[model samples]
Target: MARQSGRHFSGPRLSPEQAARQGRISQLAIARLGAREAIAFLNGNDEKLGGRPLDLAIESIEGLRAAEQRLDEWAEA
Candidate 1:
């Protein structure tokens, strides 16, 4: 099986250790999304001659959306 980060299995059921690890991983994932959103929001405020910053922000939002989709799929599984 593909091993998930910060996860460990023990016996027939998920132990407290595994649950705690999963919790930490979930927290980190949430934090990452929050950071990405913040970056995108801040990037949106940039006003420059060229559209480079806007382009970058759009790319970042796309990447973040993809990542969120993947995470949702993983959670469903």
Candidate 2:
């Protein structure tokens, strides 16, 4: 955060591409896991990824790929 005009302002928001990536992960999760389970899966920490799936998905393309792969793996199992 930064102060401007004696008011605090937050950091930059996600870019359009980042928002799109987040949507991709969310939609995929909802498709495979259903709404309730998808919410849990995204929020829950994964042993393989070593982080929350949603966080990873939002971070980068590579992390998004890993998250999607994990979801597929979960659905398969």
Candidate 3:
């Protein structure tokens, strides 16, 4: 852990792109899945994604699109 002003940092900070991905995915999930399902979907592992949707989405543009596609599929069902 890094220390600054006697405070210890817990983990690496999110970059701007990662932050953007998180915001986008969260909004989409909440809008399509509602609050409860959105939380579960983001935090839970997805068989189709092969990882937690939120983590995949923040990893890259392709992952974000994949997560969005899954969200759409769930919303339509």
Candidate 4:
């Protein structure tokens, strides 16, 4: 017996407005810090930083929540 992959796909494409909204969301997700700073911090290259995965994970979650809130506000406007 062969296993079948079940998948359902839909949608033609995102409209220009939708694409712009997505771009805004992406920007909001990283608004808290510079990309380079975040990369260095996550890799434990920053001074006063110990290699703590848990702390980094928590920070990432917080950042996501903030970005979600911003997106919500944008949607309401």
What is the C-alpha lDDT profile of model 2 across 8-68, one tens digit per residue? 6687789898899899999999999999999998999999999999999999999999999
Model 4 C-alpha lDDT per residue in residues 31-60, reported as the tens digit of each score: 644565334333342222233322333345
| Residue-level error in angstroms, candidate 3, position 69 | 0.2
What is the C-alpha lDDT profile of model 3 across 3-73, one tens digit per residue? 55877889989999999999999999998889999999899999999999999999999999999998888
Q: What is the C-alpha lDDT of each candidate?
A: 0.43, 0.93, 0.93, 0.44
Q: In model 1, which range of ten residues has the least summed lDDT?
A: 48-57
- Using TM-score as the yardstick, the better of models 1 and 2 is 2
How displaced is residue 17 in candidate 3, in Å?
Answer: 0.4
lDDT of 1 by residue, 1-77 (tens): 89679967685664565454444434544565465643453344333312233233234544434434444543454
**TM-score to true structure, per model:** 0.28, 0.81, 0.85, 0.30
Candidates' RMSD to native: 16.3, 5.0, 3.8, 12.8
lDDT of 2: 0.93
Pairwise lDDT winner, candidates 2 and 4: 2
> What is the Cα-based lDDT of residue 71 in candidate 3?
87
Which residue pairs come into collision in candidate 3?
none
Model 1: colliding residue pairs: none
The worst-scoring run of ten residues by lDDT in candidate 2 lies at 3-12
